[model samples]
Target: MKTLVISSSPREDGNSHVLAQSAIDGTVRAGHDAEHVFLGDYVERMLGNCRHCRRSSDGLCSLDDRYETLLLEKMLPADGIVFAMPLYFYGMPARLKTVFDRLFCYTANSAPQQDQVINGIMNKKVGVVISCEESYLGATQGVIAQFQELTRYLNQDLVGVVVGNANSRGEIVNDPTDPVSAAANLGERLYTSRVTDYRLDTARSNKVWDCSPVGCPDR
Candidate 1:
């Protein structure tokens, strides 16, 4: 099985990244191949919120950006998806949100409300690893609420939601069975439920929108 772990922290060695990498290592230890993707690696190449929704008709994004490869190669085919996010203003980072926003393309061909279209994540399971500075109970759940809604909309199965408490690098190591280990376990646990069809329409790579209205780079 292939597990794709998405590290959303801007810093390469940030706590979130470390935990994500650890999860990947655990996934490998459990007899599976995994990929640890750093969002910072492609953030600059991404033009978030293109506002075109052209994929709805053309079966492809309107604007040409990094999202095509990111979605096609890593996201669509993966049996399991892990989102390692660092808390910002008690919520997910903007870059991760940008990635999530682009996912609207998955359901582009169907009506916004629901003319009946089953696409996107299908039966894939989603795992969330949250890193927060505050130890308050609501800190992590606050973000989980948003992700829960998104998973429901995408028709994804949210298998796990783990929270890591730390601000500095490597601090997550203190807890022997905390998020770090949980994340690693999640890598293999998702295999309990699998989707038979793992291919999606990812051939098109054209962006056909003029999204200067939101003005989020690449304008």
Candidate 2:
């Protein structure tokens, strides 16, 4: 199996990137091919102006940029994907969100290859790694909810999530949680695990989206 590890941190060798590398190492150890890419490298060509453009006859995005190359050549072809990034405003970094937004072009399109593109995106194994400064219980909730909903919508299996607490670059190396090992384990599980259900496991007493005046009363 081929797995793609994407690091969205602008700083090279930052905490998030380090974890991404560890995930790649795990994938390799599991006898799978792993490719790592820095999402910041594609920031300049990211989707923005294409939002208003009408879909072409081929049902492709109007903007002609390398995102197509990244999606078709790297993302779609991979059997599994690991998204690693630092928390920004308690959510995903803007660059990573942009990539997800661009995927909208593939939806509800009539192109002959649309089915292929959609199928490539759906029902894949996925993993997540997040590095945040705060170790508080809710520090990573926003981003976690986002990924959970996204994978659920795409019919993908979210194998595991590893959150590292690191405020400074490379600080994750000293994190007591040992997120590096956890990330590696997540990567290995990405291939070995099977998808019994695509739904988000929300049976917990305190579900994040449970917005009520009193908050989960059961909790």
Candidate 3:
């Protein structure tokens, strides 16, 4: 199994990235190959929203950008994905969101949503590693719901979420058996689960569309 870890934290060696590194280590320990790409180091251009143009679902962006082509190629080949980041104002960082937006454009245009036919494609499993200034008890559930929705759209299984209590680089190492370790364990579990069992363990929680226009018909 090939695992790809995406570290989207703004900090060069932030706690979130540490968790991502742990996951990579765990993947290797489980006899699976793992690679990581730090989005902060990449020169990715901000992706524009879909224009609803005459675009085809072939995983190719109509516009030329710094990282779009490369990222699309990576997305097509990876078997598993790990998204690691720190929550910024209850949302993802602008760069990470832009990457997601560009990917959305590649997947669909308007009206009905369908799968894209990329040259190298596979149904992959996805997991998230998070680091926050505060504990995981507060508004973190919202983030989990967002990732769950994203995993559903990508047709990937969400193994679990790992949260670390730190705001600086390498701070996650303080807690040896905390979310960082859990992140590593999650990676090992992912490698084993990929071959032994493949099931979507959807967490029963809040409805993502609860605050959407449809969910709030009163609007």
Candidate 4:
């Protein structure tokens, strides 16, 4: 399967990014094609409310911007999309949230003249990878609810989430094996499942496919 991983952390090698890399690594190891897009590396401009002007026919953004051509193009036709971001003040990062905001062109806020693509948002599964400073990782419920609401708008499935405690660059690598193992299994589950029924709380606890009876990579 083709998977698109979006890293929303601004740090060059932050915890969020480390978890994202692990997920990408697991995806490739499972024989799937995975590509990562670092939001920090891109120039995603903040967009305003759809002007609803006759110029709406121009599916492109009114402002001459980079995302209009680059990241937007990649988002199209991907089977699955993963969002990796560090929790910022109990919520998503500002820039990443801006990317989500820009995607509103596909929805009700679209300008009347905006050249919005028909069925611009449909038929994709979404996942999340998060690394927080707290050891207990207490924000899964809120994050899952947020993703669920957003996915409803995009008509996408909220497949799963991977939350790991990470305070330093690459610290997650040395952290407990369960979350990382859970991440790898999540990649495999995405490949095998069809209807997307996993719950964030249970998935993290069940540790599906993390390790086999013999301790081999279950994936």
Write down the lDDT that model 1 would get: 0.72
Q: Judged by lDDT, which candidate is best?
A: 2
Ordering by lDDT: 2, 1, 3, 4
The list of candidate 3 runs beyond 4 A from truth reads 41-43, 49-64, 109-122, 194-219
Backbone clash pairs for candidate 3 read none
Residue range 159-204, candidate 3, lDDT tens digits: 7788778766788878654887889888887744432233588564
Point out where model 1 deviates above 4 Å: 45-64, 110-120, 175-177, 193-219
Which run of 10 residues does model 2 get worst, by summed lDDT? Answer: 202-211
* TM per prediction: 0.74, 0.83, 0.74, 0.77
lDDT of 2: 0.82
| Model 2 lDDT tens row, 1-219 | 999998888988799998999999899998999999888666544555444564755445666567667788899999999999999998998889988887776655544457877988997899999999999969898788889899999988888889999987898989998999999988877877644452486454543445676763322
* Candidate 2: segments with Cα more than 4 A from true spot: 45-59, 110-113, 198-219
Candidate 3: residue 154 lDDT (0-100): 60
Task: Write the number of the candidate with greater TM-score, choosing between 1 and 2.
Answer: 2
Order of candidate numbers by TM-score, starting with the best: 2, 4, 3, 1
lDDT of 4 by residue, 1-219 (tens): 888888888786788777677778777887888888877666456776555421545544565456555445666656788888888888888888877776665444444423443354466777788887776546656766788898876678877888887776877877775667767666656655544355666544445555567875423
